[model samples]
Target: MEEEHKFIIRTYSKAELAHLYNPDMPLVSAMRKLRQWIRRNKQLSSALAEAGENKRDHSYPPLQVRLITRYLGEP
Candidate 1:
């Protein structure tokens, strides 16, 4: 899913994404780091907020996931 190689964009759980980004860290810490990264990016944060902010939400919608990947460059 790194390049344009026919990757299928899909919804991802927060925990799943956190694990993807920081498998070396504990789950909670990893999730916190992911959230921190999102919050730190103004463009990404605003876009997500416009879509409907819900930090407590368990998973990301397909489109929101797209934005995340676009901003964060594919977990």
Candidate 2:
């Protein structure tokens, strides 16, 4: 008898990420900035969601800014 193992893997490419960043952007060059930003700051997405649910004032640079600063460092 032989033992079998399974594993999960994920992959991402600059072009793919760029497309995600901006669907409107030219396929040739979407910049991928937003995609990279999200990848780098996964926490931001969660934090933003939380802020939205709480109905907190997101306009001012507070919740988001603070979270971003803590994760990415001072601007």
Candidate 3:
């Protein structure tokens, strides 16, 4: 018999996301930098690709917190 592995995906609320980026900075600016960080880091492309699979809204694509942590090395 073969064993199957399951992974849990984590999603962050706006407040949590902002804190992860920078608790000392403004939330709006933190989010902007987070987006820019994602764009510049090509290694994070796989994480974004996974996010695309479960995207709910076209205007606001969902980002996986676990994947972000994996690539970004946690907050």
Question: Number of backbone collisions per candidate, in order?
Answer: 0, 0, 0
**Candidates' TM-scores?**
0.83, 0.37, 0.62
* Residue range 1-75, candidate 3, lDDT tens digits: 999644334556645665666878887788777767777887785567756733342222235666676777666
Model 1 lDDT tens row, 17-71: 7888788999999999999999999999999999886978999888888888899
Candidate 2, 32: how far from true, in Å?
A: 7.4
Global local distance difference test of model 2: 0.48
**Segments of candidate 1 deviating more than 4 angstroms:** 1-8
Error of 1 at 36 (Å): 0.3
Badly placed stretches (over 4 Å) of model 3 are 1-9, 53-63
Q: After superposition, how far is residue 58 of candidate 2 from its true place, in Å?
A: 9.1
User: What local lDDT score does residue 43 receive in model 1, on the 0 to 100 scale?
Assistant: 99
Scored against the true structure, residue 44 in model 1 reaches a CA lDDT of 99
Against the true structure, what is every candidate's RMSD? 3.5, 14.0, 9.0
Worst 10 residues of 3 by lDDT: 53-62
User: CA lDDT of 6 in candidate 3?
Assistant: 49
- The local distance difference test score of model 3 is 0.62
* Reference-based lDDT, each prediction: 0.86, 0.48, 0.62
Candidate 3 residue pairs in clash (backbone atoms < 3 Å): none
